[model samples]
Structures are given as C-alpha cells and as structure tokens.
Target: MKGSRRAVVLGLVLTLAGCRKGKEEAPAPLPPTPAEAPAPGAPPSQQQALPPDMRRALSSIAPLVESVKAAVVNVEVRDAAPSHQDTPWNGEGPDSPFGEESPFGAPFDGPREDAPRQGLGSGFVVDARGLVLTNNHVVEGATRIRVQFPDGKEMDAKVLGRDPLTDVAVLKLQGDVKGLPVVRLGDSDAMRVGDWVVAIGNPFGLASSVSLGIVSAKARDIQAGPFDDFLQTDAAINPGNSGGPLFNLHGEVVGINTAIAGQGSGIGFAVPSSLVKELLPQLEKQGSVTRGWLGVAVQELTPDLGSALGVPTGKGAVVTEVNEGTPAAEAGLKPDDVIVSAGGHPIASGHALTRTIALEAPGSTLPLTLYREGKKQEVVVTLGTRPDLEGVASREPSPEQEESPQQRVGLSLSDMDSRLARAQGLPRAGALVTEVVPGSNAERAGLVPGMVVVEAAGETVRRASDLARVVRDAPPGDALLLRVAVPGGGRVLRALTVPKQ
Candidate 1:
C-alpha cells in the first residue's frame, strides 16, 4: 500500500511540474500593413535612441588612437651583472657603491661571460629631435637602454636626467631621425572624470599593446609621495607598462603610465604629462630639477579643524609646524596658521599646497594668504630650493647636538637636534624624548611620545639626560616641573613627588 501511494505522489508531482493548460491553437497571422512602413520607396523612419555626446566622442577619438600608436615606442632596459664582482654604487669593483656585503656583488650563475639583462617598457617620442619621456624608475639603475620602434628597428638611448620624486625621466637617442612621429602633449588639467583614454605600452613584454578605458578618477593621491597628483585610469596598464603614454581622445599625450595598483584589476595611475612638459625644460637645461619649498609641515584641514580655524568649507592646509630659519619661518609664518592660498592658488589640501609650491620657481617670491589666530594675513615669501630633493639640506646635525646627553628618566634623549627637528618638523632645539619605558617615571609623569621636554624642575632641559640628571639631583619630595609641547597645544605638567633613592 505504501509503495503504491508513493508512486501516486511522484506521478502527481511530475504531472504538476510539466502541466500544460488545455487551450486551442487556432489563429492565422495577418499580412503586413503599408501604414507601418514607409510607402513606395520612401526613406525609413530614423531612430533617435543613441546618445549624441557618445556618438561625437567616438567619432572624434577613432582616428586619434591610430595616430598615437605610431609614435609610442617600446623601451627595453638591460641590467647585466658585471663579468667581475662589481660594487653596487659605482657598478665597478667590490668597493663600489653596492658595498662588499651586497648580495648582488657576486657574478652571474652561468658562464662568467657578459650578457645583457633585459626589461621592457613603453615610451613616446615627444620631440623629432629624439627626446622621449619615461618613468625615472624604468631606466634609473639600468646598465644599457634601448628604444625600439614599431618597425623593430632599435636605437641606443641615453638618459638626459631623471627626477625620482616625480618619477619622470627624459631620454635622447644617439642620432636624430627625420619625419619622426612625435606625440603632442595635452593639458591634463582639462581632463574630466569618465573621459575616454587609451594606454599604449609593453605589458608583460608585449610591445605596443593598446588598451582602452575611461579616466576612472583625477588628481588621485595614492600616497606614493609628496608630488602625487596622479590620474587614475582603467586602461589596462600592467607590469612593464610603466613609462608609456596615456593618450586623450585627440591622440594627445595626457599622462605617463607610472604605476598600477598592486594585485588589482582595472585600476592604474599615470603621472599627468602636463607636469612632464612643465618639468622637462628644467631637466634638459639643468642636470637636476629644482622646486620651490615652503619649509613648513602642513596638515589637512578637517571639518573640526576648519571650525576651529573659522573656515566654513574646511578648505586650505593648516601649518602644523614651521622650521626655524627656513623660508616659511623667515617669512614670519608660524604654527597654528592656515595657508589659505599660495601663489594666488587656493590651498585645498596638503597635496595641493605641495603642488602649488612646487610650481613656483626657486628664488621667486610667492604671496601666501594665511589665516592666523583669527585674522587673514598676507606675506610674500622668497621660495627656497626643495632642500631634500635637490640635496641642499644639511644632512648632518649641528655641533650643538654632539654635546647633548643620552639618557633621561628611563627615556632616551637627543638634542632637539637640527636634523632631528627638521625631519620631525619641530621649530627649536629642545630635548627630544625618544623613548619612555612602560611604567617608567617619565611615562608616569604624563610624558608621552614626541614630547619636547623643555624644562625640568624649572631648569632648562637641552638634552635627554638633562631631565634625568635634574630628577636625580632634585630635592626629595619636590614635584618635577616639565614643559612640553603637545600636538594641539603646549602645557606644563607637574610630576608626582618621588622620594630620592
């Protein structure tokens, strides 16, 4: 009985699943009507569904892509290990820059013969004179560099100069070739998000590979460095795509493919070639690029900070610290001031401030509008050479730092040393409290990280051991007074009375 019931249920289920209604299928289709179509050789009705902007964009860009491909060349770099043990820096003997302890200081594994190691990149001829622009990282350490044309013809190239901070480099061929198809540079500032862009590069050793996509974003700060105004595009830039041209719809070079977001798809960044055009002349004229430096550490203005500074829109970069005797400080700039404008351009963020300052020529005077302590002040600052980038900043500490003590109250101290203070964006020389042990006397006294211990027991603290020595020689049962500058403000803290040992 159970088996029969199960069979009936299964049959019901199948019948329901496959059920078709009982219906008649008796109808004849009607013939075509003349009203629905144009009568007697008239033109058919036009459809208006296509977007006009898209059509215009496609029509304008089609020819430009092909034109751009003609000038974009593949770059091949060879980093051949020397036949003998070569130092890293000089590329010569063991005592070379790489040092004797360098892992790559040894020779190659195969026959002790010289072989040209190879790497592939992409670049476009910017001038008929054989001037090409590429990423600095592409050929910086290369031993031999070669540029290959679309016809498979190759020429040896020499580096004109390179700026690592911007990752821009210029290369020139040995001989000038006539009728060279040079790519015209476009204004990247005019680019808008979602605009179509094409990238041509040698991705994974595939030379002259073209990929298409739209500008995903603009002025993207990937936190690569100080000069990080990058154009983020999704045009399939990959490894070996570095140093290639990112072209706009008119076949104008807009950006240089410098980096791709790691381990990701459809995310890449390019350095705007407009910067290349701006900096190339300087690179060619001089051996290095010199940028204007403000010598102030700036912080982005958040909503709360803007409110505190009375900026309703939260615009501008706030000067958090100013280096003494530097351009900003010499111009009477101070901490707690907001840089609302530089060189007449509005300061939007820290990056914008850097970019604006960089655009100014070294030794030129730049007018800065600053908001300080509730008032707008204008100052003309003579720009200084970007010390670090140009290797102008004194790398060594001043003579005063050598006389500073080492230890203080379970904390390591150094002279609010020049190098340390400059690197840390501190204004004056004070005791730099390096480390305070957990549960140590200094830590218990509310001495936190980055505190410049200025005073101990009303005596000036010039070094780390100043605090330690003062505390050691202090009269028992007396509170230790410490003056330190916090991130937001400065305060004097009284350490709890400690019995002398």
Candidate 2:
C-alpha cells in the first residue's frame, strides 16, 4: 500500500522544468564577422547578411558572454544513495556543517534505499584565490566534487561551507590559488523586469552552453524555503544548470541559478546577489547561517478578513495564534493583531514579515507597528534563532502521534491538535494519518501513514469526515489529488488512484 502514492519534492524552492515559454525572447544569434566575408570575388547579391537591426541585436550579448564565460564552471558530484554505507546515515555526510544533532536530513529526494547516483550542477569562480559560489542543493551529499573549467581543466574542490536555508554553498580549490579568473557580482536589487540577462552553465551535461533572456519576474515566493526572494528568468536553466551564474549585460553575476519551475516551460529562478552578499561572510566564517525569528504565526489579510477586522488599509500580516511563553505572547501580541511595519519599514505580507524578521540579528530587540482592537500601537520584541523546519521550538511529539494505525483503503488518519501542529510545523488544519495498509491503493500511490493530509479532492481535509467525504465524492477508478506532508519533512502532491468499491 505504501508504494501507490507518488510524492514529488521540488527543492530549496519549487522549480518547473520544461521548454521555454512562448513570450520569452530566444537567445540572440551572432552575426557573421568580417573574417567570414564571402570569397574575395563573390557577387554582392551572393553575400547574404541579416538586416542592420537584427545584426545589432545579435551582437549585444556576445561581448558580455566573452567577458564572463571564463568564470563559469561545471560541477559534478558522485555519491552513494542511502545504500551500503558503513556509517548509519542520519541523512548527512561525515562533515555536515549542521553537525550530528541537526534534524535536517539528506535533502528531499525519494527514499534512499537505492544505488549510487551522479549529481550534475554549475558554479562560478568569485575570487582570485579560487572561491566558488553555487547552490547548496548542487553539492550537498557529494562524496567527491570535481570542478571543470572552460578549457576542460578539472580540479578537486572541497566544501568550505553551506547555508542550506538560503540554498547557497561555497567551495575552494584544494591547494593555494591566486590570480585565477573570476566573475564580479552585481546588485540584484537594481535589476528590473524585462532587463536583458544571460546564463552560462552546463545543461544536460553539455558544457559551457549560453542562453539569454529577460528577467521574467522578481521577488518570487515559491515556498521552497524561507529566504525566497527569487529572481525569475526566462533563461534556459535545466537540471544541470543549477548553481550557474545569471549574468547582466555588464558582465556581472546578478543571480545564482538555482531552480527551474517544475511546472512551467523555460522558467527558472536565481538567488539574488544582494542576499549572496550578506551570506558570504557568514558562510565563510560560521559555516552555517543563524537567522532571527519572531515566534508568531501570521498570514496575509484577505479582502474579506480586512472587511471583518475593520482594518483601514486592508493590508498587512494578521496574527493567527500566539504561542504560550513566546516573544509574541510576552510582548502582548494577540490573535488578530495586524502587523503594519517592522523597524519603520512597512510590512507587505506574511512572507515579507518572515524575511524581514529573518534578516534581523537574533537577540536584538526590534520594534513593530501594529493595529489591534482598532487602535495603533508600538511593541518591542526580542528575536530568537530561527527554528528548524522540522524542529518546532523543541516541542515533543503529541500523544496523537502514538495512536494505533487504522485502515481506510490504505491510510489511517488521526486527530491533530494545536500542540502537535506547532511541534510538527504543520498547518493548523489537517487530518493526520496513522497507517497505510499494505497492497492497498493508498500504498500503491505512495501514501504513508504518519503523513499529514492537508488537502484532498481539491479541498481542505481537517477532519476524518472530510477525508471520507472527499473519498466518497471521487469518481471510481480516477485519481484524487492529495497534498500530504511526507514523513521526515517537506510537502508533496500525490495522485491517489481510487480503487473501485
């Protein structure tokens, strides 16, 4: 029964992988140079050429490519996947920067009981001494990392440090290095939508391929991770393109290509260089990043909620439930408190608040502007270290987690209380599954018990009755959409084939 559900986890951020979008401009082609001039005596009409405008457009990106291609490198990693390793795996390598006790595991790939695998990605040299920047997802769990340059010179590299929260990793060449070719990082905040950009990376193991497009969007929040102010581009960034540098016309690296939207064609995301600027020193020194947390649950205020709450602006992050003894509770923050600003800056949404708080240093007191009970007030709260996604305030598992597994086709869902929800970092509303029957449809569909069912049949399933109703309403032999929290962490959508009654 456990094998029936297919769980797909898009990493660090959700990515869509496919062809290019129709609206995006294709890479500009280079015009024929004077060196390729038609044979000396060729007739004028026989000498074919593109129009002036086309030639000019095609030539704009070639100079930028020539300037930055030297810094781009292809990264390859070979590692064993959850099988036949001497040390009992806790989901990390021997030198994990997070240390042994970290709750984070070996990324959100499928079950580990498989064989060895090869990971392909990209990166760029950032300094003359051979410091390289790339996505953490590219090098994580790598047993050996090999860096290949434009001239096909491959060198051994060691992981210096990685900030998984931001999906950024830094590496260094094995020996002393100086005066090596490098790429300059630009201000990602200065880039606007429709701005021309180019990407140089190894896609599908093809080395040093170049693609160009405009910045399709910015500050995209895909919910792949917390620090998610991604710059979306139409550049052709495929699987092997992760960790590559997305360059601007000035030949500066503006973003680090990280993910391809798993649903869209030609849509890719990059980590802003501004954020990379902040993370460099910390990752270089501390080996991991520690972010500040507000200890409050909040969500964006919808129009209906705004009307009901009497909010004048009808915009801000609305407080959900303040946990006991947390900074929010201690600061007298209550449910329905609309956070309008932090340290004088306006808060746009819950995600904005999340990013703002995370940027602040822990243990520092920060001021918040809030609207409560139809009155504006100021509150000061001390920030705490950001909690692990799977480690919620170190709360113990709820007794509900210990309930005996039941059987419903293949799944046995149970009750979930606020305490368990907080402990598990789960949505407040969901039906918890305790078991999955072997050989059942749910099993075949990869639905494991202990995985929380947040939505089913395209609707919220907060209770057992909701699950039953959704199951009953489904047409026989068709598939039911279920968004479930897979065991160990990370959420995935599974298509559970409904067995005919």
Candidate 3:
C-alpha cells in the first residue's frame, strides 16, 4: 500500500512540474516599487497639451499687441458749435441718436458759436515723421485737434486734408512726435469672412480699449453715402471707436473703424484698407478723392430680369440711363445694356460696378463686357473724373397733391405739373409717389410715400400715366427698376417684383 501511494504522489508532482515549465513565466512580477522611482516627485501638477499639434498656434497676442499699441491713438477735438456738429460723441443732448451715424456732410453757412464741445474718437499713425490717418469727421471743423499716444504723450495735430466724399483724412502732428510706431497694412481683399480681427480705439474717452471678433461681412452698404461699401465686424466697436485701426490676425491693419449701427449691439462698419490705400495718396496730394466716372445710372439685376437679359442674376449692373457726353455714352453704352464685367473683374452688382469705376484712375481705358440683345459685346471707355456726387433731388415735397392708381404695384401717384410741383417744391415733371399700399410690390421695394419716382422700367417717368404705362407694359413675372429720390438728398434704386399670378 505504501509503495502504491508514493508512486501516485510522485506522478502528481511530475505533472505539476511539467505544467510550470511549459508556462512562459509572468513578467517577473513588475518590481516591488515603480520602474523609474515615480519620476522623482509627484509628476508635474500641470502640463502643456501633448503632441504639440493639439495647441492653437496663436495662443499669445501680447507680442503683437505690444508692437501695435504705439501706432493707435486717441483723437480729441473741440468744436465751436456743440449742437450743430455733424458728429457728436456718444449720447449727447437730443442729438445722441444722430452722432456717428453718417459722414460729415457738405457744410452749411451757419454762425459759429462759442460753445466749447469736446469730442473723442480714434486714429492711427501712418508715417514715421508723424502723419496719421482717421475718418474725416473725426477732425472735421475742429477748432483744435489733439492726439494722445498709448504712452500718454499728447501732441497737437493739424488736419493735412479732409475728404468727406470718402470720409477719410490725413493729419500731421504739429509738435515733436519721434519714435512712434507705425502699423503694417494688410490686404482687405484677401481676408475671408471668418478671419479673426481686433479693434483698438477710444470708446467714450476710454483710450486704447481693445476688442476681439471676426469679420462678419464685407462690402456692406449702409446707405450712408454714394460710396457706401463698408466692412462689417462684430468687434465691440462703440461711439468713440470711429477712425481706429481694425487689425487682422497677422497684426496688420485691415480696416479703419468708422461707424456703428444707430441701433445695434456689436454691428459696426469699417472703411476697408484697400479703399484707404487708394484714397490716402489722393487725400494727401489733393484735399479730396478724385474718382473715375462713366456717367451712367445703374441698378442691380434680379433673377427674373436676368432671365429677360439672358444673364445670371447678381452677375452685373444694368444701365438704366447714360448721361450724354459721359464716358459711358461716348463708349456707346445704351440703356438696358448689362455691364457683365468691368476693369478685369466680375461685376457683382451696381455697387460693385460703381466701386470699380471709382477705383480706376481717371483717363484710364476700362475694358468692359456688355450683354446686349441676348449677345455679349466688348466696349472700351476712357474714364472721366466723377463729378461731385449729387445729393438727393434738390426738390422738396409739398403737401398739396392728388392721388391716382398705380395698379401694377399698388402705389398712389400724382402728376408733377406746374401747380402741384410748385406746391410741393418739386420740378414740374416726373411722378411723385404719394402712397404705397401695405405689403404691395412698391411697399416691398421700400417706396416710401414722400419719395419722388423719377424713373420706371428704366425710362423717365413724367406723369402718373407714364409710370402706369411702363408698369402695364412689363410682362407678368418681370421686374421693374425704379429710381427714387429720398427726402434727405439721397438717391436709391428699388426693384418691384411683379407677381406672375
């Protein structure tokens, strides 16, 4: 019995030993302590993101901010008449809503008052010898102008020139201003809509206030002036932000802060740097902006109208009228011609064409493509100086009038005869718009009751019948372009979409 038991135990031991030998032996049981002594201490409490690619490249704007802070400045001005100033600062008296909403317009002959009205805005140094750039209204009609640097050094500034047409101006520091930093200019045309931007300005006398945002839009027309293409940004620009530098991510000036919405939060407009580049030299050389003009009234094309013209909508401007002896007329451009492209760039709208011509140098030949009568043709026009932009119609609206039906668009019109025109202080011609029916085509086109409708369907409208006839002639589902004169000396082009049904 003892022998059998010993033999069984021995066989079991052999089996256990063979199994242990076949197994690869567990990793030597990790060590009794950490392999590298726990990294010497408690491992870093905080560490940067791993792999380097996980971090944003521009985490610090300090270096850029420091480099540009010197170029920006606070503009202070004193005006003789407080109430009558074209641009008042922030919210002032009853005129608060009107301040900074528009450019400093053509001056009126008014007596200068002794009331000392102090204003604050912003500007930037452009020349190392002390030349500065700012909005014209920032220093317009200033009894005295001063510039204060970020370093707290204040110097008197003299307006080198002013161009209210472009609302741009150049200034020279009257006193010693050495070692002032100048900011680099960037291509406004190259900036994308989502690109980051920064604004540095003096808001409400707070000098050098910085705000960050993105480019919200470009080529925005706020109806402030004839040349109203403005870059819109949501960069916290405020009342005193006018004439400040709008910087791109590259630390370059891409725009100049000019205006904020009369009723909005963060909605601000800046004159683009491309325009600044074009206007600066002219403003510095001549005290104004000299633009190339073609002497043609234009309106944007709609899809239905584009179909009628055989061109794509939003691709060009249609010639409503060409003034005799103007470059456009000289070039044989006729009414209804579609300017598809001009000056080597695609025309996006009437505003785009207007901007193209205005930017081209006077006397330069501009190559243009016109889609006429369902075919495309090319024309070359030697540009002419844009005459002083006309303010809205000189005629004012008088109260006396008779209403007649404009059935196509639901507008009430009146004949501008000698009796009615003289009564309303308007010319004895054209159709005066007396009423626009709510929710009608005319109303949808923004045809106000007091405006003067001078043109309809691209033809001069002389009487109620003229407008009615033009409206009646247009085929159903067609669009009509109306040139109306706003009461505030402004002209606007409106489109009435005639319903197909």
Candidate 4:
C-alpha cells in the first residue's frame, strides 16, 4: 500500500512539472482581429486603433533581428592532436585567464586526449574586405580556423592580430571576400544601463541563435584582468557563444559577448566597443598592445586619511610606494604624496590614475599635479612600457607575529629586529605590530599584527618610540594617520582615533 501511494505522488508531481513547462513554452497570443478594430471614420478617442501589420511592426523585433543576422558567423577551430604532456581540453586550463569554473562561454571541446580537438565560437564581419573581430580565447591555440557564414558557406581564415590583454582578436578571411556584409561598431560609452540589446551567436552548435535582453549594468570589474570594465547583461550567452556581437537597437555593435556568470544564470559580460576601438589600431599594426607604466603603487585616499594629510577627502590617489629607478622615483615622487591630476585630467581614484597613464603611449611625458607637505606642486614624468604580469603569482600575507610588551591604541608594537625583518622580508627601519587588541581603534583601522608602521604623522618611524612620540604629540580627539607596510609588499594608510584618557 505504501509503495502504491508513493507512485501516485510521483505521478502527480510529474504532471505539475509538465504543466509548468508547457505554460512556459506556449506560443504568444495572436494579433487582434478585424472585428476588434475601431470602426472606420469613427470619432478619435484616447485609444486609437491601428492595423494588424502596424501593430506587429511596432511590437515585434523580427525586422531588427533580420537586418543584422547576416553578418554573424560561426567560428570553428581545430587544435593539433594533443601530446602526451597536454591535458585534454575540458575548458579549464592555464591558457584561459578565467580560472576553474571560468565565467567565459568556454568553447565546447572534443572528448579525447590524442584526438584533434575541435571547438566552436562566433564572430562578425567588420569590414567588407572580410576582416572579422572575435575574442582571442576563441582561437588562441587553434592550428586551423574556419568561419561559417549564415548561408552555410565556410572559408579559411588567419589571425591578423590579437590583444590578449583585451581578449580581442582580428581575423582576415581568405578567398575573394569583397562585398561581405559588415556590422558597424557603436559608441559603448553612450550605452546606458537598461538599454535593450540583442546578442547573436551559435550557442552549443545551434547556429544563428538570437537572444534579447537589457544592459544590466556597466563598468563591472569581475577580476578578469587589470582592464576589466565589462558590460553586464542578462542575455542568455552560453557555451559556443564566445566572440559573438552584442548589438544595440540601432543595429550597431556595442559590445562583444565574452563571459557569463554560469550556465543558465542569465548573466553575461561583454567587452565594451569603446575599449576595443582604442586597441584596434594598435593590434592591427603591431599585433600586440603596449601600455604606459608609471612605476608607483597608489591606494585610495579615504576621508580620515585625507583629513590627517590636509587634502580633500576622496579627491586623489595616495602614493604608497615609488619603486627605485622607475619613472615616479626619477621624478622625485615620494610616498605619501597625493596625485590630484595627470595629463590635465582630474584623478578621482587610483584606478583612474592607472587607466589614464596606461592609455598614453610609452615614452610620453605626462604632467602631474600633486600635493606634498600640504602644498601643491607640478612635475613631469616620462612613462615606460608596462611589464608583462602574466603568470606572476601574488605574495601571500605574512604569518602572525608574536606578542610584544608595548601597547598603544590597542596595538602591541616592537622595534623591528634583524631576525624579524629578515623573516618578514622587510627593512629593519619600521615599527612592527605584534598584536591588535580586539575592538580597539587600531584593529578597527585595519591594522593586522604583521603590518609595519613606516610613517606616522608624516614622520618616519624607525622604531616604536618614534611612533609613540608622534602619537603623543598629536592633537587630542583627532585621528592619527599612519602609513603601514602590509605583510606582503603593498602599503596602506590607516587612520586611528586617539583614545580619550
């Protein structure tokens, strides 16, 4: 009897599930009939009736999709048979910038290690002479590439240039390619959130699939790379949809579908066309990108740090470190200096400064406005080529230090001894923090036990006494600013409120 009851319940559940799926896939309602239309020559009312064709044209996006679908192409790539050392292509590997469980619509791979691996992606023609644009990852290790047009025509193609930094690649189709339909690149800067967008691609080898969605957000940093300003959307971008074009309502390519949150998440990312356009000329000419480098590490200038430094809060990037012999050091830029502007553009944040400098060519002299010792100063520095950071591992934080005797502002401090300095890979010229009292101002200020206080109240702290002296001399009820070297290699500013005696 129990088994019979269980079977009945299972059948009921399946019936309900089928009903929901049927409702979801049901066809849309038909257009209004002639009897439902307003009579001819009737007095005009607020609700004016329209012909069925006019209503369909107003309500449907079929025309727009038809107009732009021709330029979309399917990109198929085949890799040479894998060697004994190579792992089979499961869409997760060192070649992919996105790590395990990659956000990109990773190409579908064949299922064998020794077999030639085949992958499918999407691309669009941007020039009548058969120049095409797609994502670099789509064709990164392929030994052969072929582009399949909507009309079932396939043509061999070669990589003209590729910028791995931007994940963009340009391909030139071979064999009499004049008069190919092309899509116009649009101004991504003008695209606002919530604007409607259409994505066309071959998802899962289903050719010529179109999905409609709105721009969910913009300038999203998914930690994909240093220049991660992805346009987030709710479009259904799937595997095999990589390198597809994202079109605006005006039939212009605003972005390139590159990554997705996960399968069936309805969240995807696209590279803005603005950044693509900026890199296209260089990629076409040099086949690689060269970014300008200013050899200074900067951090955000918070309100309390700004108050202690006598600069406007949230206005500039604070120099944390100036590498030796670099452009910043050569220009005499010191730690604690606040960079307010660069190249005539206001520097609102550290990211802004980095992006502004990177956009300029190497060897270009850039004028900078900075605040040092509560005074404004101007300097010019020549930028250098940015170093390749690929494959460089980040330093992990140091282990917690042993507790010390001296305590202030809820911190136990000690002068950096030779042994401690060597262990932490730091110079012996700073006061080392050994412990942080829970709920204390120092702990609240983000002071960890392994940090070294390098500067306090704009004065160098070579020992704990130096920090104590600076704190003692500081005004009562004011925030004490300290520049601290973190356990790894970066510096950060902390503002601690002096405890009331």
Native-referenced Cα lDDT, model 1: 0.65
Each candidate's lDDT (Cα)? 0.65, 0.69, 0.68, 0.71
Q: Please provide TM-scores, in order, for all candidate models, with all chains considered together.
A: 0.61, 0.61, 0.62, 0.62
**Where is model 4 more than 4 Å wrong at Cα?**
1-58, 81-100, 106-108, 391-501
Better of 2 and 3 by lDDT: 2
The prediction achieving the highest lDDT against the true structure is 4
> Which pairs of residues collide in model 1?
88-98, 89-97, 89-98
* Model 2 alpha-carbon miss at residue 415, Å: 51
Error of 3 at 501 (Å): 68
Give lDDT: candidate 1, residue 493. Answer: 68
Global Cα RMSD, each model: 27.3, 20.5, 28.6, 25.7
Give the least accurate 10-residue stretch of model 4, judged by summed lDDT: 3-12
Clashing pairs in 4: none
> Considering TM-score, which of the candidate structures 2 and 3 is the better prediction for this target?
3
* Model 3 lDDT, full chain set: 0.68
Please report the TM-score between candidate 1 and the true structure.
0.61
Candidate 4, RMSD to the unseen true structure: 25.7
Candidate 4, 110-196: lDDT as tens digits: 334433445678889988988888887676655557798999888888778776666788998988897788888988889899777
